[model samples]
Target: MPRFVFIGLLLLVSYSGMPQDKNVSQGRSTTSPHMAWEDLLQEHVQEDGRVDYKGFLRDKQRLDSYLETLALQPPKEQWSTQARMAYYINLYNAGTVALILENYPVNSIRDIDRPWVKKRIQVGAERLSLGDIEHKILRKMGDARIHFAINCASISCPKLPAYAFTESGIESQLNQAARGFINDPQRNTISPKQAEVSKIFKWFRSDFKAEGGSLVDYLNRFLDEPVSKGSQVKFLPYDWALNDILP
Candidate 1:
């Protein structure tokens, strides 16, 4: 065989034998590990999104183990958008629960001094507050649906999902969250002519309208009975009570 042909064959064999990056493919990273978080959610979060804090207290060690996994493996730039989105959403939620457990028997998350801005969550070498995860990272991702995914441990906040958000299912999961929150009568009383919606719409007005449309237009997408374009929208008072399952 010619020297150039032999060299080409050798190079191909060498390249094929090299270990590939398991986390990456086509410039996107694989999904983050979330089975532990999912298990915790299934065990403690109720169907209605209310939490069994006391149960969580009993399972604190499992929760901490999951959080430690996340803290050590901060998302990389190569991660798919969905992967990153799921990571932050789960991190924010798990971290919030950890925070609440740190101060169990509290009436509301707001009762904690500066609950959101406190930098207690450690991801890799960085320390981030819940506020950082929501505002600085998730919001910047430009997915309005996220507002319905991250729970604030409040009655008025969107329900905490019973399952962990996974990269493969993130899109559908977000759509379901938005639809559920928008249509749930406890959160929003909607009519063809008028609507009284959650304060979430008021607080994150820009996020809902991030895509080119009115807030009402956004609601129409999720409402079973679409509100009239000219319907009067009243923002309801937010309930800051903890979303705990009382015995």
Candidate 2:
């Protein structure tokens, strides 16, 4: 090979060997390469969605490392819809856990003053609150299924999944989450005549109705037994108790 051609090949190989930045992706795909959050979730979260706060406390360092990675790499507009959805959902869930750890031993998230409004989450160059991520970011994405994916660390809120959300599986994972939350009798009760559901439906009525039709229409999508279109719907009193595992 010519001397100039050999030098060019050497430079290409040298650049390729350099470590790539996690925030930068070469293609349309934009998802985290590794999810440390999944390991923590599998270890501390129960199958029933109850959390072992003590266990989380013991693994605080791991959780913090994962959160730091997320904070340094915020989602970009060029990312696919699934990628952004998964990122925000995971960010909200992980941020909630970090908040709880900051105030461990509390009975409920409500005990913390302005828990959702507090701007404690640091994502890239932006500092946001839990509410900002949920309402301003995720809700605006126009996917109502998001209501079931982001947890509020309360019994009435949707259960936190044991695995992290991935861009590749976000569609299926979201469908499963919606079905699980709607059918979980503890959270919702549906019949052909009347239905009683979690306050989530009431609080964010617009979200469920954004696609048009009544709340029952949305419930029927995931419910085993469909509620009548004109059936009476009642919102259950939200349980603000912490979803902590007991010995």
Candidate 3:
């Protein structure tokens, strides 16, 4: 081989042998990556209680870029506990919205449930499907609050926030999410005499109670006019179909 070609081959071998920076090895850039998940959380909330989907879709590059910073290592000293939680939450939320758009022409997200809707999802050049992100990744790794955070594009489903999630702001974000969902009449609030609750409270009644509040206490925090104490509560039939924009 020519001398220059030989040198080039030697350099390639040397580089391959060197220890790779896991964050950079994947060819992801976290340089000046958005560190405050709160900024993303604030942007997520809109006046209408609906997330800013159009804005999020427009900045798809940022979401993809940020996710690349996620650690591929096991939950250990290499990864901050907070980072792991933020990563899982971000993936769940972002992947869900991506799934809806990938199949958006359909009237509802329910359309994606058919056996034929299978498709590959590319995040940071890694391919996984919506099902993989939700059931395989988020559900497997996250806590019960996730049921409230992961929006399925349904009106009855918890609304997707416009901003991204970060570890720093998770606690406040969760409280805000719980409050927001509880206040939305379509989701949970109703008159004192006839309260129709989200299946969320029923499904995860233990989650709220665990935090020192019964489902009633949780709902009361967000009620415009507090429901009378001791009022009977009823659960509304939750619509699991997709929350699509109507023409």
Lowest-scoring 10 consecutive residues by lDDT in candidate 2?
18-27
What tens-digit string does per-residue lDDT give for candidate 2 at 90-206? 889998998999999999999998999989999889899999999999999998999999999999989999978877677888999999999999998777899999988988999
Candidate 2 deviant stretches above 4 angstroms = 1-34
Location of the lowest summed lDDT over 10 successive residues in candidate 3? 24-33
Please write out the lDDT profile of model 3 over residues 1-247, one tens digit for every residue: 7999999999876543312223431222132123333245455445554555565567666655544443232233455545556566666565566565556554566767741135444544466665665666665554555666767667788877654444455565666676677777677757866677888678667665665656667667656767776677777887866554333
Candidate 1: list runs displaced more than 4 Å.
1-32
Candidate lDDT scores, in order, read 0.88, 0.85, 0.58
Query: Which model is ahead, 2 or 3, in terms of TM-score?
Result: 2
Query: Where does candidate 3 clash, by residue pair?
Result: 40-163, 44-162, 44-163, 153-243, 154-243
Q: How much is the lDDT of residue 164 in candidate 3?
A: 47
Candidate 2 lDDT score relative to the true structure: 0.85
Q: Candidate 2, after superposition: displacement of residue 137 in Å?
A: 0.1
Candidate 3 Cα deviation (angstroms), residue 247: 4.0
Which digits, one per residue and each the tens of the lDDT, describe model 1 over residues 178-199?
9999999999999999999999
Clashes of each: 0, 0, 5
The predictions' CA RMSDs to the true structure, in order, are 7.4, 5.9, 8.0
What is the clash count of model 3?
Answer: 5
In candidate 2, the residue pairs with backbone N, CA or C atoms under 3 Å apart (3 or more residues apart, or in different chains) clash, namely none
